[model samples]
Target chain A: MKVRVEVMLKDGVLDPQGEAVRHALGTMGFAGVESVRQGKLIEMDVAEGTTDAEVKAMCERLLANTVIESYRIEM
Target chain B: MKVRVEVMLKDGVLDPQGEAVRHALGTMGFAGVESVRQGKLIEMDVAEGTTDAEVKAMCERLLANTVIESYRIEM
Candidate 1:
């Protein structure tokens, strides 16, 4: 099975990387870019019988930093 | 308007970061993780009137390295 994990910074967390991108876009003359937030997308190929709980454990254990990021899993 | 851009390495390109993650997962005792690929998700808040062409231009010129990465845009 294929599992996709989308990990994003929790709201209110400072995202220096996203801010940098937004600034770069402004300087590149792409006006009207009000804000930007950057996140990660991890695609995984697992054994057919891999359970959702196992995948969730993967995120909790490594894929995401739960203190500052939230992740969603899609199968 | 909100725009989402997903940028991923082109197939056949080396992804050392993904490999490292996979290795880490293996060592952490998460078996059945056959393969992993990591990508970026960029979310932007743009002016309401921003057109798709402009957004595509952003991806082509700044968001993704066309030589090694492909990007998908969502609204």
Candidate 2:
């Protein structure tokens, strides 16, 4: 089965990399770009019937820094 | 309006970062992890009714490296 995990910074956190991208965009004349946030997309080919709980555990353990980020799974 | 762009490396390209993460997972005992690929998730706050063409241009010019990456946009 194919599973995907999208991990993103939680609200109220500062994202320096995202800010750098936004700055570069402004310099490139992509004006009026209000805000930008960058995140991660992890695609996995796991065993068939991998349970949601197992995937959640993976996120909790290694896939995300839950202290500063949040993640969601799709199958 | 909110928009998202997902960027990923072409299949034939090498991803050192992804390989590093996979190695880390293996050391942490995540067995049976067949394959993993990592990508980027970019979220944006743009003008309402931003055209698809505009977003596509953004991907081509900045969000993705067209030589080695492909991107998908969602609004």
Candidate 3:
């Protein structure tokens, strides 16, 4: 089985790294760039018997900073 | 209408940052750890009338490295 997990900052959280990327892009002549926030994508090929519950556990325990981020998993 | 876009390397693409993050987690005594691939989460709060076509265009023009990545947009 395969699972994809995404972890991102909660709304209102400050994202300095995303801001830096936005600044860099603006300097490159891109327009209407809007806003950018950055997070992480984690993909793994698991045994065919993988369960969503187990994967969610992986997220709560190790994949994200719950104080500042929320995570979702798809299998 | 706000939008969130995620950009990720195609499968088989290397993710040094994710590997580094994984290594750090391992040292922290996290177990049942698996592989991790890193990508980006980009979020924005647009005007009430933002269009998906425009967002897709933005992804094509600037948000993602089409050569090595793919993107998805959510409203």
**Per-candidate DockQ vs. reference:** 0.92, 0.82, 0.42
lDDT of 3: 0.76
Please list, in the order the candidates appear, how each scores on TM-score for chain B only. Answer: 0.98, 0.96, 0.89
Candidate 3 per-residue lDDT, tens place, B1-75, comes to 467888888878888877876676567654444766778878765556667876777688778999989998888
* Fraction of native contacts, model 2: 0.82
Q: Which regions of candidate 2 fall more than 4 Å away from where they truly are?
A: none
By lDDT, is 2 or 3 better?
2
Q: Rank the candidates by DockQ, best first.
A: 1, 2, 3
Residue A5 of model 1 has an lDDT of 96
If both were scored by DockQ, which would come out higher, candidate 1 or candidate 2? 1
Model 3 — TM-score against the truth? Answer: 0.69
Q: What's the distance in Å from true for residue B26, model 2?
A: 2.4
Q: Point out where model 3 deviates above 4 Å.
A: A21-35, B18-35
lDDT per residue as tens, model 1, B1-75:
999999999999989999999999999998989889999999999999999999999999999999999999998
Q: What are the runs in model 1 whose C-alpha is more than 4 Å off? A: none
Clashes of 2: 0
Give the docking tier of candidate 2: high
Which ten contiguous residues of candidate 3 chain B have the minimum total lDDT? B24-33
Worst 10 residues of 2 chain B by lDDT: B24-33
- lDDT per residue for candidate 2 within A1-75, as digits (tens), equals 888999999999999888888888888877777899999999888878778988888899999999999999999
